[model samples]
Target: MSWIMPRRSLGHAISQLLLQFRIVSAVARRELQLRAAKGLFGVAGVFLEPLALICTFLALRILIRGAGEGTYLNLVLWLALGFIPFFMFADVAIKAIGGVQKGGDLYFYRRLRPLDSLMGTSLLTVQIFGTMMLAFVLGVSFWEWEFVVENPGRLVFLYLGIGLIGFGVGLTTLIIGHLLPIVAWVIKSFLRRILLWTSCIFFPIRQIPDEFRPFILWNPIAHGVELLRQSCNPAYPAPGVSAVYFWGWVVGSIGFGLFIYANSEELLFANEPLPGLDDGDADL
Candidate 1:
């Protein structure tokens, strides 16, 4: 009787349990709707940080007129292009943390996985805001600098690299947020400061002293920024970064994060009760 149950039936059940693509998509859509409900306030809050940054970069360009050799306009465009990925990275870090905490509610649903819920929210934000940010970048480039998509191939590669880095970082942050909910704010703040200074956001990497260059070059964000600049600006100097290094970081970080999540998933549920469930021993 058991043998006659059919191998296809078992395979289908395994696929459903392993992937749960439908559940992830549903959760992602729900997250998008929740965020969209906030309307303009949500829109403004999402873009304000990046907008202020662009203004500040432009202001500095004016203040430093005649102070250096590089073209200010080129630098502004390059910085803007590079900053988009960094902003995405930072957003992932912060939001992944929030997603973990907020996702306690979904844990009550037996079919829902914690990681799937977190990933769904993360993907929702990426899909919504990522397109908007990319459009804004292209619009600004076209209107202000007359930039055009000369090489679609390179642009596609650039986006692939950026998405890989973002996913790896976001997954790592989810694990960190789950583990250290209390000090997560402090940890994020400290990392943001370090990333800002080391990422060469305001200046060229060459400007850093030789003594500190070796250490600063270890930052994966720097590699991401450099790659973005290379894709955007023809005249931009190649930073001689190894693509292997960036990909390695992506693989390593995501692997570690998944291992942590798998090992501690039950603990996460045990430590924090699901949103609606009142019983102590309810399945997570």
Candidate 2:
């Protein structure tokens, strides 16, 4: 009977997991459709935001310093790798801050939790940015007439790692911001200004002065970005980046975020009225 009980519990857990996955997938699909509808070129136009940011930065780098001062890797590829992954992380974390509020209406369904909305947003951001990164890399490869991705595994690991970290940070931010709104604004500012500069998007870590190198390396996103470029061109010099350190941030952030969410999930919807309940007419 004991063994049967354990088996039953495991089977139930698996079923619940699959059910949650289906819910999240549905939410992600809905989000994509809504976003695509807003854009002029439908789905294709949704990509233009990131593409424009990358191009603007790439042009600034070329105009200010010429094409890739210290690297043998194709200049466009180098910047794309940095810009694409960094934006992936940034988009996930920043968008998560408001996910609960924007998705409050979703809670009318008994199974749809606030976390599901955030997870859906994260999924949509990752898929969109991941596609953008691949498209840009392939475009650059064809333009340069060379394939530079030496370690495809490493490239994938960094992309997913950065996205996961972003989800975690965004979760943490969402909880704290619900408690105190001002903190969210500060976090957004920090991510946009401080995090962006420290991420090594425009310049490699090798270019940093020795005394300042440690400060930059302290940011896990910096490690992910530098490591990603190194994954493409093995010779691309990455002096102090560590895979273990990067993973440390990934595990720690996710664990802490989950811990906080488990404790404070109620607070997110405590004061806000569900959409259908206010009207007293809507049904799931």
**lDDT (Cα atoms) of all candidates against the true structure:** 0.65, 0.88
Cα-based RMSD of the predictions, in order?
A: 5.5, 4.6
Q: TM-scores of all models?
A: 0.74, 0.92
Total backbone collisions for each predicted model: 0, 0
Query: Residue by residue across 75-114, what tens digits does model 2's lDDT show?
Result: 8878888888888898999988889889878899978999
Position 155, candidate 1: lDDT: 56
Provide the lDDT at 187 for model 2: 93
Deviating ranges (above 4 Å) for candidate 2: 272-284
User: What is the overall TM-score of model 2 with all chains considered together?
Assistant: 0.92
Query: Model 1, poorest ten-residue lDDT window?
Result: 66-75
Per-residue lDDT over 1-284 for candidate 1, one digit per residue giving the tens place of the 0 to 100 score: 77757887998899986678788888987876666566565645544545666567556765876335245335445556555666666666666666666777787788787788877865665555466556656776677776644444665565555555666666666566666765666757855777877776666666677787778788877776666666655565645465678778777877786787787777656655557998767776
